[model samples]
Target: MRLVPLDIDRDLGLVHAWVTHPRSHFWGMQDAGPDRVRAEYRRIAENPHHHAWLGLDDDGTPLFLAETYDPAHSELAAHYPVRPGDLGMHVLVAPPTTPRSGVTSAVMRTVLDFCFADPRVERVVVEPDVRNAAIARKNAEAGFVEERQIELHDKVARLSFCTRGAYEMSTPHLSPAAIEHAHRRLIAKALAEFSHERLIEPVPDGDGYRFGELTFRARRFPLEHWVVDPHSLRGPLDALGFIAGLRETLGIPEKLLGTYLEEISATLAGAAWKHHHRRETAEELVHADFQAIEAAMTEGHPGFVANNGRIGFGLRDHEAYAPEAGRPVRLRWVAIRKSESLFVSARPEEDHYRDELGDETLDRFERKLRSEGLDPGDYRYLPVHPWQWEHKIAVTFAPDVARRAIVPLDAGLDRYRAQQSIRTFFNVDRPDRDYVKTAIAVQNMGFLRGLSPRYMRATPPINEWVAELVSGDDELRACGFGVLRERAAIGYTGDAYHRTGTSSAYTKMLAALWRESPVPMLAAGERLSTMASLLHRDRWGDALVTALIKASGQTPAGWVAAYLRAYLRPVVHCLLAHDLAFMPHGENLILVLENHVPRRVFMKDIGEEVAVMNDRPLPPAVARIRIDVTDEIKELALFTDVFDGFLRHLAGILDVDGVLPADEFWGLVRDCVRGHAADHPALAGRLDLFRPTFRHSCLNRLQLRDTLQMVDLTDQAGSLIFAGTLDNPIAS
Candidate 1:
């Protein structure tokens, strides 16, 4: 398909036919005569800010009508903020003479691409009638975010926007240049992480260090962190070749080497795709919305080398569900026999499905159940990842389906976007709705990304307990620290799998939970951002944190201090004062921002990640979160998970970007921890945030040792694979 300028003289009749058709009532030109339509087109032609286009098929046949205008100069300027690069767009597919499957969606994408064809355009805006649900879905599929309903001159319109980055993300492809670029960066990361884990010790060469045939200059940080310069590296650009060359040195098991390499390949491909399609610069992302920043992040986990190894996802699945893809998805629903399923919630009185699915959807689901000769009250609704339903549940649980223990239902109406944590989803259709995290039996990082049915029962209770702790504590509440509680959970068990009594992926397949959204917590003028974006860098190696600091209008040190207080202080307080430690990684936290500076943080992934280090008395329902570990091991939660896993990467970004030196960054963190210690002197010396040295808990080591199920969640302390100790960067 292609776009050409709409000629008023030649295309007037065709355009009039499309706008006057009964299906085109939303176009608002249904009553206009041919002369009136011609006059409208003539007016649009005369207006410099507005232009029209006719989408043509291969044979030069017009299939759709498209229009572009400058929102800054159009009627939309009064409704919303019109940035310099924002361009308005409108599309109407000629009511198809012969029905086509995806013609409208394709036309919408083409018009968006046409608008963005001009390098000056960074965002595309749309204003469809609020009642135009068909156009609303089409707009969402094209990555447009509906801001709000506005009373336009013509009608009540749903004002929406799509950024270039989000559009490209929704439609991604691989490029040879991007592949080579990503390989070099991934190889550099592998070398640095492998060296840090003591898998391969690079010996000093002339100006840099050499490992096997690879050579690079790197700055060694306090925790033996290697900051390798991607450009300065002298090595083969082949990631697989580099890994194969040092297979013996890295000590990857002979049997698992190929599997590990496959993961490496997938990671390389994902990174390359991100590099190729991602168009947002650090400066532009500084002012972006929460999901925009999320979709713009290039790197996955900072410490892990094979972080994006989504093994089961095909190319189409990647486009449909990958977090970086920014594609909206509807979750597949199923009805499980209530006797065989478990539904638990923090608030039993609240009908979660009714709130999430709405009354019409609930009625439709009940009707489906009743149509199957089943009683609606006999079954419970459970949402599953579409991929999982097609790939795993349909085939593996066929027996249960035949026996009427499980009945497949239709997909939900709400559109959700995949979160950075692959299993979790954000409700893009309705921001205030709870986040639905589903089980997708795809191997990523070190485990099949599935929700354990056993854990599902305790999820809501554990989250309730943690939320209470955070809210009741002054230190946590003072900094606006909060947890997005998993308020409800549903797990469906196939009798066949249940009889086996194994904790494998099969047992974990069909479970989902609802976590409270951070959107409802925002006050006026406040925005949300993923904490991971703080460490994100653009293609030009500009750090997002640096852009944020510049935009905040605060001194570098002052900005760093503010971030530490909002994020670091609460983490330390939780550990030192409450003897509770969390996985507080960047992806697990959301930052509340005001004027581009972090004002507070909200922690998620609660039930599976939170651990009580001491032998604290707990309710039985919330007891699963308690992990018995020594004081030394407890300290690793900060040193290893926080400082080494996360801050090390952020420090490297700021240092490389020349925004803040690593020393000064860690010093601010030290001050944040010390100030909290001063507040509670009785807990001051229990766990040392500032110590001379601490154990280096190796993350890559865990993945390398076992590519599947690396850490047993129940025995988290015993499952750790640690190397020798390293100097603490925060220690005086």
Candidate 2:
């Protein structure tokens, strides 16, 4: 294969046919005629940031369409943090006129080489529509790491990137040894996580713990930092079959079992995606930033086995929109009838959201509704995940649309970027606007990640209650903890015709909530970064943590102490003082920084993640925050979630990078908890309830047992699965 200029006039005839093929779903040219195709390519050729090319076979026939551009200059709208030397690209292989083998791969390889031929290009990025699994697989073959799904004008494209070094070392096949290693790693993770969840107990068989069967028939490495090392695994390594066999044992329903398996397969596929690339050393990722560190995050959550199980997403979907893809997306909007929908506002009246949707934008929406013979006042506008709107709503909720109960509208005005969770978006164009969390029915890591319509009614009050508590508590204010309230929530219950059933997806289909932006809360010299990004490393193995420590001129221990004061201290405070717990994982929390050093913490995703264990509540609006659970299970919100789930992994990185030692890491966390107790004497009794050492809680068990609906919203804590125990390093 070789590079050839894609002459718009000459190629338009053949390109149109290929793009219009039913299989070319992501190309978005189904309705385009010859002239339209020409105009599109011509625009690409005209733009300075973009170029159009064709891959030609040995016989000199064009095999595919390729477009390359500067990502910063593209319509991507900066959904991602644009770095220097980033290139954006897209390709559409000419439909196979006849049975052919390796043609697509060959075309991709050529396209890759062509892009890399430019000495200035550091990485090649592309966003194929999320449904294009074939192309996604091809991208992995070309050494691409799937970043996340981004929204473009027309489709939800999977964002991905490839480095010349990674692509040059890519292989088309995996050796048996590689497959064995991958399988063992998958099974090993499953064993540890599932067993921890109490879903399956592994018996001592020969040398190792066995679950469901003797495949416990494996054994080897000892625990490192109180966590299982997957590489030491050896035995029957069928992750899918293992989970399926445990269906009844795990006590999951059959309907969810199928979805569970699909998620597992997708997780395995993600491992396979990285299999072809030359693995980057932890030392390098420690130094890298943006896409570099994100790429190194091949392991999802260490506690979950099928961490990346985005089931509804095919390889293509995974490529385009997975949070890791780091693509910018513009959410689709719809006007839902006020009678069938609900909007709870935290700001006076609906001014918060009204100001967000500028008067000009609202005027446009009103004109659109009026033109359709509908009244704007009777509707509440909800932003829908572009993927959910395209794949589910257009067809599933067509009846409501026909009746004018749900009116499809244009994409929102501002360009928004996806946060770690694919459905939540931060407006890059208008950073001060409240962050919008929309419902996406696509099932990923336990349950369809849809914002619950039934739950949205109580969200504002829950957020307000927490925000009020944080503000009123002088100690919490002194600790610099901030809670970004979900200012407003809106969702449609659906009209009678569309009210077919209240399945998880249907009920969540048209819901959105706006979280207060941390931008407005930042101090004069402060900046914002997702706490998850602290774990980010630059391409050179430089730790953002190390960088922060250096910038602060603090010892590694002191930097950690500051971080704990901002993040971990508040978590401990919420639990001890108010019987409140926030999911303190990387993605859900944001850290305010002063010259890249920690300053304060912000907690988000209040509607679902925030929970109060006891039923001691007075306000009816905030009563929903309470969840029933045993005292033992309540510790998990801290022990497992904050410590084992988040800190353990971060410690591993700092330890492996030699920037911080493991012992000192655990010691720091212990000091933070102990300090909080010492400072707040009134809560001394409550603080004693949180032990340094506790049982190991399992997250993947719930996901494995049921990907469709892992936990009951009504009984969030009661749904927990627990097994065994861990010798907490923080134990005093």
Please name the candidate that would achieve the greatest TM-score relative to the true structure.
Answer: 1
lDDT of 1 at 255: 89
lDDT of 1 by residue, 1-732 (tens): 689989989988899999999999999999999999999989999999999888996347899988999898989888887899999888889987853334575577668767888999999999999989988977776788988899999899998989998887663335567887888899889989998999988899998999877788888875788888887778678998888777777778888888889889999988876775576788878878898789888888898998899999986687678988776789999989888988998565227778988889889989998898899889888888999999998998888988889999999998888999888999988999999999999989988998877778999999999999999998889989999999998888756777788777788888999999999999998999999998898887888999999999998889888888898889988988788888899999999999988999999999899988777799999888887778898889889988998888888778777888888888888888888888889988987777799988888888888888789888988988878888998896
Q: Report the C-alpha lDDT of model 2 over 1-732, residue by residue, as the tens digit.
A: 677878888877888898999878677889898888888888888888888887776447878888888888877647887778788888888888854444566567667777888888888888887887888888887799988898878788888889878887665545465555556667866665555455656667565554554444432211123334455555567778877888887776887777777777777766655443325544443334333344345456656676777667655455446655444567888988989888888665447556878888888889999999888888878888888888888888888898988899899888776665767887767778888888887777776787767778888988888888889988789989988999888888865423666555667777888888888887687877667766654333455666666667778888898889999888888887778888788877877877556779888887678888776754899887777777676777788788777787678667766778877888888888888878987876763444545776567666655666778877766677666676667666
lDDT value, candidate 1, whole model: 0.86
What 10-residue stretch in candidate 1 is worst by lDDT?
A: 98-107
Model 1 misplacement above 4 A? 1-172
TM-score of each predicted structure versus truth: 0.80, 0.70
